[model samples]
Target: MIALKRLQILLPFVGIAVLLAVWSLTVWARIVDPVLLPSPVSTFRAMWIGMTSGKLGVDFLKTVERTIYSTAIAAIIAIPFGILLGSSEKVYRSVEFVIDFFRSTPASAMFPLFLVLFGVGDRTKISVAAFGAALVILFNVAYGVMNARKTRILAARVMGASRLRILWDVMLLESLPQTFVGLRNGVSLALVIVVVAEMFIGSTDGLGQSVFEAQQLFNMPDMYAAIFAAGALGYGLNLLFLTIERRFVHWSGK
Candidate 1:
């Protein structure tokens, strides 16, 4: 049992090791052009240097800043609005189609519209990202609240809890898991939108800009480094949210 548990703990690393091996083999065997796909060492070295002593670090931070700002704005707007809608089925139904429609629209497609509205500034990128994220969060939160266990809500009411109290306690608590799910999804989408916007939105410094510049220059190593940095950021953000959920929403899976 102990051995099985230990194996499970280390299981995720197996994929990493296999991927690295395959990558290294491909590079060594010249299966792909070296100019196109750098060795893992070359890629990591570029990543280390760019992050430590070059402009890549600044660009990475800028992307982080934009993603965080957008996600925060999304959560702030969506959470309360979601609660209101969730608490009233009629209100939720009234605008469900509208919410889903906009949510279905690609954020990239909205860039031109937002650029027209806010111009080619940080405002346009951030606001467009926020708009996309807000719909995802709002949809999840409303469903979470609406799906709160009826038994618990009824029990609260039977115990003489006011509507406000039941909402604050029972419904909100029940909604936390799904809310976190929304947050995670929203942040990911926000990051993607921010990166794409940075690439094309007249930005001077950002991971996306770095990637674009590197690709244009045919600097494959540096481009890979930037790509890995962006991936790391997304993974780190998701892990952070998951950790917070595990701490605060301990009963989430149960």
Candidate 2:
């Protein structure tokens, strides 16, 4: 059992190792043009230098700021609304169509509308990302509340819990796991939107803009480095939420 657990822990690294090996082999074999597909060493070297001594670091921070801002906005608006909607199944059902409609719409499709509303500035990009993330979070939070164990709710009522009390103490706690799930997913979507928006929405600096500019300039190493940075950022965000969940929502899986 100990060995199996250890192996399971190492499983994630195995794929990473295999991927690096394959990439190195492919580069050495001249399987593709080096200009288009830089070696991992070269890519990582660019990543290091760009992050340490170049504009990439600034761009990375800009992207992080925008993503964080959008997600915060979404959560601020969605959480309370979701809770209110979810506490009453009738209310949630009445507006389910509208919620689903906006959620189903691609955020990108709203670019033109936001552009017209907020112009080609940071406001438009952040608003669009916020809009998209809100729907995702709202849905999850509502579902979380709705799915709260009925037995617990009944028990709370039997113990003389009022609707507000049950919502605050019982339903809210029950919904935490699902809420965190929404937050993680929302942040991810926010990052993606911010990146894409940066590439085309008059961005002066950001990971998205960095990648776009590098590609246009044929700076393959820089482009790959930026791409890797974005990937690392996404992975880091997800891991951060997971850690928080483990810390605060320890009863999540239970």
Give the C-alpha miss distance for residue 193 in model 2, angstroms. 0.5
lDDT of 2 by residue, 62-104 (tens): 9999999999999999999999999999999999999999999
Q: RMSDs, each prediction?
A: 1.3, 1.6
Model 2 ranges off by over 4 Å: 1-9
Q: Each prediction's Cα lDDT score?
A: 0.96, 0.96
Q: Candidate 1 — what's its lDDT? A: 0.96
What's the TM-score of each model vs. the native? 0.96, 0.96
Query: How large an RMSD does model 1 have?
Result: 1.3
Per-residue alpha-carbon lDDT of candidate 1 for residues 82-172, written as tens digits (9 for 90 to 100) = 9989988899999999999999999999999999999988999899999999999999999999999999999999999999999999999
